[model samples]
Structures are given as C-alpha cells and as structure tokens.
Target: MKEYKISLPICENDIDTLQAGDYVYLTGTVYTARDAAHLRMYEAAGRGEDLPFDIKGSVIYYLGPSPAREGQVIGSAGPTTSGRMDKYTPTLLDMGLKAMIGKGRRSPEVIESMKKNGAVYFAAVGGAGALLSKCIKSAEVIAYDDLGTEAIRKLYVEDLPVITVIDREGNNLYDSV
Candidate 1:
C-alpha cells in the first residue's frame, strides 16, 4: 500500500491518486457529523434548502466527540460506526462530498455511489479516540447545538491518520481481507 499526505477540500485529482489500503495523513478542515447530523442535512436537501456548510469537496468524519477536559481542543474524537448513515450517504456523495472517515463496511449502494461520484472512504482505527483527539487542533460547533456532542463541528486537523478503505474506483479493502 502507498502512503500519502493530503490536504482537505480534496479534489478529483486527489481522489484519482488514492487506492484502497493506502495510508493517509490528512491535514486541513474536516467536518464532524454523526447519523443525526446526516439526517438533518438530507432532509434540508430534500426541501431545497441550504445545508449548514458547503458540501463541495468536503471531508466528513462520522464523529460525535465527548466534552473536553480543561485546556483540551476536543474530547475523545473517534469515528462512530458507519453503517448507520448508509441510507443517507448516497445523497451526500451526489451532493459533492469528497470523502468520509469512519469505521465499518458501507452498504453496497453507498459503494456504488462513491464510484459514480468519485469519492473515497477512509477508516480510522476504532477505540483510539483519545489518541485521535490529539490531532485535532481546533473545534467549534457550527450547527445543531441541541444535539450536543452530535452537533456539527468544524475541526482543523493536523496529520490525522486514516486508511483508504474504499477508493474512487470502487476497490474495497474489506473485500481483500
């Protein structure tokens, strides 16, 4: 597998260079959203309303971090199970979402949409929340404050590690294992 360091707002060119199982360290803006946030965005789109943030070229992490301790930028910022968002993923992909960071296999429909939309999927190691939080340099809730930890947060990450579990060409690392 190859290793790459990528910046956020990844474009089609960046997606083209990635392959399943590649190691990547992402440094840039990443939005955190869990299933609750996804559902809100999906509903907003259906109503022809604007999403809270620009969806184009965005990388979303399916995370809902806990309350931070004193002096911390964020709490345990781990990825949640991805399957719960399967029903809403295809729509987001078509809306210009570039990549997603989460754990677990995605549904076949989500995989197909990724191929059609030229998106990538990254997997963060689960149960490594404490370590991952160190990569987040800043965090601010940008929407859905009522959801508390599940609120959509704009995070600036530095060298956050992830594995390319599914590439734009539809290669799936899970299938290889």
Candidate 2:
C-alpha cells in the first residue's frame, strides 16, 4: 500500500499526490464533526453566520464515539456511516472543504461535488474501534459540547490509517472494489 503523511488544510500538492486506493496516515490537527454538527454548520451558513471553524482544506471526520476510558485519549473512535452526512456534504464542499474522512459510500451529489471542487473522500476501516482509537494522541472538544459525541472536537493524531475512497478526479475505489 502506498503511504502518505499530511497535516490538515491539505494543499493541492497533498491532494494531487493521492489517488484512489492510496493509503494515508494523517497527522496533525483534524476537526471532528458529525450529523448534528453538520446540520448546525449548514444552518449557520444559511443564516450568513460564520462557521465555528474554517472549512478551507479542512478534513471532517464523521464519528460519534463512546467516552474515552481512563488514561486514554479517546474511545472506540471509528467512522460512522458516511451516508448520514450526504445531505450536508455538498454545501460544505461549496464552502471550501477539501477533504472528508469517513466510511462507506457517499451519494452521487457528494461525489460530483468532490470532483467539482477538487476535494477527496477517505475511508477508515469500519468497526476497527480499538485499532482506530490508538492513533489518536490527543482529543479535546472544541464546539457544541452539549451534543456529546456529536460535538466538534480537535483531534491530534499520528499515523491515522485511511484509504482514498474518492479522488478529486471522480475516481471511486468502492465501485472498482
């Protein structure tokens, strides 16, 4: 498997180097946002309200994990179904999101948006809770604390394994798989 290590707000060089099926070990800061957070973000965008965080080149991980165990940075943090975020994805992409990390297939509209905006979709292993959680070195909630697991969090990770599911060129590994 081909491997890459990148920081967030990934640039064109990072996106261009990746292709469908490439394995990635993302480091640096990534913001976590799920269905609730996505909804709030879309709503804010509709109301002309500034987002809680900048969306440019941001990688949003779709997850709602169990509380971290003692002495652990995070708990059972794995990708939730990507479909849940489909409705909100295009809007975010239009708003300048460059990368999204989740699992499973995304809708055609989302795929189209990725192609149109030079964005990429990545897939983490499904149900690999224990394995996935170990990659997170630090975790702290940055927004929507009341939403619990659905809240936005800033995660500092190292070698977080993922596969390129959809490339900016509109290649989808899922269909070929």
Candidate 3:
C-alpha cells in the first residue's frame, strides 16, 4: 500500500493517481450526506432539477454528524455504513462525483461505475468520530435541515485521514482480504 496527501475538489487527474489500499489525507472542502439526503438528491436528478451542490470533482462523506459540543465547529463526525447508500451511489458517480469517504464495502455496480467514471472509494476509520471531527475546520447545513443530523453539510477539512478501498480501475481492498 501507499500513502498520499490530496486536496479536495479532486479532479480526474487526481483520481487517476490513487490505488486501492493507499492511505490518503484529504484537505479542503467536502460535503456530508447520508441516506435521506442522497435519496433527495437522486430524486432531484430524476426530475432533471439541479442538485444543491455541483457534482463535478466533488468528494462526499457518508455521514450524519451529531450536534457539536460547546465551542466546536462540529460534533462527532465520522463515516456511516456505506452499503446504506449503495443504491444511490452509482448514479452520483455517473453524475461526476469524484470520490466518496465512508466505511465498509460497496456493491458491484458501484465499483463498476467508479471505474467507468474514474472515481474512487475511501474508508475512514469507523468509530473514530471524535478524532475525525478534529480535522474538520467548519461545518454548515446546506440542505435538508429538517432531517436534522441527516442534513447535507459542507465541511472544510485539513488532513482528514482515509484509506482508498476502491480505485478507478475497479480494484477493491476487501476483495484482496
């Protein structure tokens, strides 16, 4: 495995450089959305409506952060189970999403879409919300506030840790294990 430090708004050129099992420390803006937010975005796509955020070169974290404690930018922000978003992921990839940060495995179709679109899948350490939250510099709800913690949020991070679980070539870390 290898390690890399990447900046967000990650592009096709960035995607081309990663391989499964490589460690990544991401710095910049990334968005957070869980199942509910994803479904809303997918439905918006179906309606030919614009999404809340631009799709191209964006990295999304599958998370529903808890309320922040006093004087904190965010709460225990960590990865959610990725499979929960599996049904909607490929569509986002097809729409130009460049990378995803979450925990666990993705479905075959999602992997295929990642390859076809030159996207990447990453795994943040599960159960490490507090540690992960330290990397996040700011957080704001961008959509679906009624969903509370499940609302879509834009986060600015510096050196957020992750491991590439699936590369653009369809290589899967779980398959190797």
Q: Which candidate number would show the highest TM-score if scored against the true structure?
A: 1
- Report lDDT per candidate: 0.95, 0.90, 0.93
**lDDT (Cα, 0-100) at 35 in candidate 3:** 93
Give the per-residue lDDT digits (tens) of candidate 1, residues 22-124: 9999999999999899999999999999999999899999999989999999999989999999999999999999999999999999999999999999999
lDDT of 1 at 140: 97
lDDT, candidate 3, 60-109, per-residue tens: 99999889989999999989999999999888988999999999989998
**What are the per-residue Cα lDDT tens digits for candidate 2 across 142-173?**
88999999999988878889999999998999
State which candidate has the highest lDDT: 1
Better of 2 and 3 by TM-score: 3
Candidate 2 clashing pairs, residues 3+ apart or interchain:
none
Worst 10 residues of 3 by lDDT: 6-15
Q: For model 2, give the 10-residue run with minimal summed lDDT.
A: 1-10
Clashes of 1: 0
Q: How close to the true structure is residue 39 of candidate 1, measured as C-alpha lDDT?
A: 94
Q: RMSD for each model, in Å, please?
A: 0.6, 1.1, 0.7
Off by over 4 Å in 2: none
Q: Candidate 3: misplaced stretches above 4 Å? A: none
